[model samples]
Target chain A: MSDPVISVAGIGKEYVLGVSMSGNMLREQIASGVRKIFQRVERPNRQQQRFWALKDVSFRVDQGEVVGVIGHNGAGKSTLLKVLSEITEPSTGEIRVRGRIASLLEVGTGFHPELSGRENIYLNGAILGMTRSEISRKFDEIVAFSGVERFLETPVKRFSSGMYVRLAFSVAAHLEPEILVIDEVLAVGDLEFQKRCLGKMGDVARSGRTVLFVSHNMTAIHDLCERSLLLNHGELVADGATGDVINGYLSGLNTDASIKRKVSNDADAWVTDVRLIYEGSESRQGFKMGQSLCVEISYETKKKVEHLGFGISIEDCIQSTRVFASVSSIHGIQLENVEGEGRARVCFPDLKLVPGRYMVTITLNAKSFQYDRLEGVRILDVLGQDELGTGWVLSRQRNGVVWLNHEWLLDGRQ
Target chain B: MSSAETTEMPERIIRPKTGLIGVNFRELWRFRELFFFLSWRDVLIRYKQTALGVLWVILQPLTSVVVFTVIFGKMANLDSHGTPYPLITLAALIPWQMFSNAVGASSLSLISSANLVTKIYFPRLIIPLSSTLGTLVDSLVGILLLFVFIFGYLFGREFGLIEVPVGVGLHWQLVLMPIFFAYALLAAIACGLWFSALNVQYRDVKYVIPFMLRIAMLVSPVGYLSSEIPENYRLLYSINPLVGVIDGFRWSVLGSEFQPYWPGFCLGATVVLFFLVTGVMFFRNTERKFADII
Candidate 1:
């Protein structure tokens, strides 16, 4: 294998919050001045403790490898990317990068609102270390790719959010840096633009350049990256193949099921907890995809609930797209009167979600009308044969999320 | 993956060091087109919507000369060292206004361009440096007004102002005008570096800078001649740094009636150089945090 294109060792970053207030105000200024004159330096008025944004993180990426970094929020994913981009310095550790790096950490990163798009393209290019002639050479191609030719002379401040993302992503993708780091910028663009960006990233990776991609979308990660790293709370938790790491993250999330409960200060009503039970056992823990599963929601009511119906919605976790939803009334199971404390269970004969994380939202409503409801409650991980592997899991590709068992007839001569 | 096998292979294409300072300078040079573009943009934008447009540049110093001539020349009966106070103040105003405007604008350059600093990697110094370059157009316009005043005084013969005898010996040392202007630019850059860095952390620095510049203008020898300063306090006055620059300008243009104050000027130049070097050091040290804080 070729030498690693990027090597990060023991990298950590510490930030001291509220340090800006130490000596600026009039009182602090005079106090500091008096202290300086007397040669009695006061202890640093450190009102805040040091917080580590990243700690002891180590990783290596081989040349031409496209690696995906996946983790939940506050997982040090952005911190690690910032360190690699050199936008922020690490308090301790070293990182050696082999070539020029261009990062699209967010859309419209270096764009000036007052400057026209044409001027900003050049300014953005210069900031990425491109010479004037280089930007001029690629100018038309970038404009065409961005689809902003008509508004080229307009200031970017007036551009729509979609237009801004398109132009920004276009500049970043066309820069041709040896190492390209992209954050979740594709999440903002339209579906077609996102597909184009993904295609461009794939093209960049195929041209023997290193790509470090960060996104919460499992589909994108699975489709693009051959290897992946998982970070949790500033620590390197998992590092391996993309599929395994994503599965590990999902399963790890399942064991710590904090998504079941709801607490609120409003006095009206709230949900207590949600659990899935199957075959006389708590089913929230694990369930293979296409298996029969039952979800139970426990709730508390301030007053009394009459003519109440329950609604269960299963949504694809990654994209927040709802796959299927069924209300108790819609399913012809009605509870005319519900009082103080109760539990409702909705059972699916065959759970047919593809291998992915799914969120179940429980809604309570009055009969023949709408009422107070909890939108999203418990989350479930559905494991497929490909996810569970052949050794320990049954092969059930016969039926999936969609049950389309129709046969098509065609003439052979055509 | 054996170490021996890897060692046997040729060394990877390691990028050259590109010394930190050299790389920074080269980056600035490569971005020279942007610098010119931004400065030109500033110039065009400044005058675009104005009714008088570039005439304001000439009007600024001309009006200031008229005001100073009334207050100091007529009302106070102050000594101008035999030259017209209008000429003296106008010559001094050119450099003084340039220095003030450059320092004032450049001080906020970084904060105003926070979006650029946070998103891109370029020498942070370029923002302030380009701002100073933008003020040069205003300075040139002020200088043109000064020449017009000089010609008016020569031919119009207003207010007992007469053209000097033609054969007066010219000082060869006056060729140091560019050197003095360089010192002024350095002083502005030094102050700009200090303020821009502070502004990134404390945003209150933005408010404090204009007040400081206003007070500094009243104290500097811009509207009044340096000769009017009491001998005992002249040295303290020269410590302001622009004293030397204004003195050098009047000496270079208005000729020998205005002698360069060497002792205080030299001390002021030294102070300017010290501030510049230290400013560069402070700016370099704080620059790494700009993206994060900004």
Candidate 2:
């Protein structure tokens, strides 16, 4: 085997939590300086806390390998990419790479709004590490891909947001680096444009280039990358095949105890536990796409209650969107008065959620007052397939929550 | 998607570089084209929506000449060393405006372009370096205006246009323009590096700059003649960086009528060099903290 195109040893980045972000005010700094002179002594304040944004992350990717980085918020995925791209320095350790690397931590970087779209294409291209000759050679292709050909002469500030994003993404997509580090920039634009971006990414991956992709879209990662790395709380938890890594990530979420809300001392009535049922057994939270799934909620009430209203709210945790609030009131289910301990089970025989992770919030209302509203009571995962075998993978956020069954109706002589 | 394309660029190692003089000149040379684009974009954007466009370059110094002529020449009766007040003040304002505007813009260059600084990695020096360079276009125009005024006075005398004394000789020493321009450019970049770096952290530099430039113009040899200074305090007054720059411009343009105080010029040039060294040190030291705070 040839040498790895990118080699990263145990690199770490530490962000001083308080000192770095805001020692900015000159007056405060001056005051501190003055106080230092008067005190005639120095001391290390215990408040100076060092938060490691990335800790001891090591990985290597051979040429032509597309590796996906999966992690939750603040999991050091972005920090790792920033370190590799040299946008910021790693506090410790070193990285060696054999090729020129360009990172698209954001698209439309350095685009001047007052400049014409044509000018910005050149400006943004240069900023993204594309030489002038390379951009000039591919100028027509970049404009053609953006589909905003007529507005190229106009200033970009006047262009609609859709046109702006398309042009920006188009310029970024044409950058041909030996190693590319991308951070969820593909999550922009509409579905059709995202497809073009993915297509461009695939073309890049096939041409003996290395790609390090960081994104929350598991389906996109699963469809594009052969290998993946999973990060949890600044540590690399797993790295292997895309399927296995995503499976491990999803199951890790489901089994995590912190997902379940703790006991609420203020509420007279509250939920105790939420369990998942798949195929008529108390299985873990992972459920197959387009299959029956059940969420059985158990709760305890201290005193007698009337007309107890219980419902479950499923939120797309990755997307930060609410999928549904299937309350007993909304679904026309009635409840009896005096309650001590009771269980409510809601099941969908054909749950058509787009495959991703979700957090459920139990909303239990007693008459006019809110008894208990437990957020993140349980984390669930929906596993999907490219059922039509068309190689189109669904994105949980880019596409909506519900997956409607339909067939292509493009006409010929039908 | 072919694998045949190649540039043979060298491999780069990424790690924390600790020291005062870690600036890699080769890396900076590799990104020379980007510096051109950044300065080009700045010059292009500056005149974009203005009604006068590049004409504002000539008009701005003309207005300053008129204003300073009224304030210092007509009323205060400051010595012009026998050159016409407008011509003398214009010569001095040329370098002064170049220094002030470039330094002013560069003081805030990193903040205004924070988006690019945070998202992309190039030599961070390019931001302020480009800002200082952006003023070169205006200086070129302002210098052309000085030439027209000089030859206009020379020719206008033959046609007998009503004349004030034609004190400007257009002497052979004018060939030294590039040397004094080096002084102005270095002074601008030195202040640009210092203020732009500090502005990234203590944004008080932003509020302090414009006010400081106003005070700097009054103290520098812009409105009044440097000959007006007493001999005892001449070297002390040369501590201001622009003292040499403004005096050098007048001596270059107005000829022997306005001789630059050589001792003061040497002192001011030393001061500029001093700040430039410390500026680079401060800039390189603080540059790593920018992407984090900014």
- B-chain TM-score for every candidate: 0.86, 0.94
lDDT of 1 at A358: 78
The best candidate in terms of TM-score: 2
lDDT of 2 by residue, A233-257 (tens): 7899999999999878766766554
| Per-candidate TM-score against the hidden true structure | 0.75, 0.83
DockQ of each: 0.17, 0.49
RMSD of 1: 9.0
Model 2 docking tier (incorrect/acceptable/medium/high): acceptable
Which residue pairs collide in model 1, if any? A276-A283
Give one digit per residue, the lDDT tens place, for model 1 in A153-180.
8888899988988888787778776778
lDDT of 2: 0.84
lDDT of 1 by residue, B181-224 (tens): 77788888889888888787777788898899889888888777
Candidate 1 stretches with Cα past 4 Å from truth are A18-46, A257-316, A320-356, A359-378, A381-414, B1-56, B82-84, B151-174
Model 2 off-target regions past 4 Å? A34-47, A257-357, A360-377, A381-400, A403-414, B1-9, B163-166
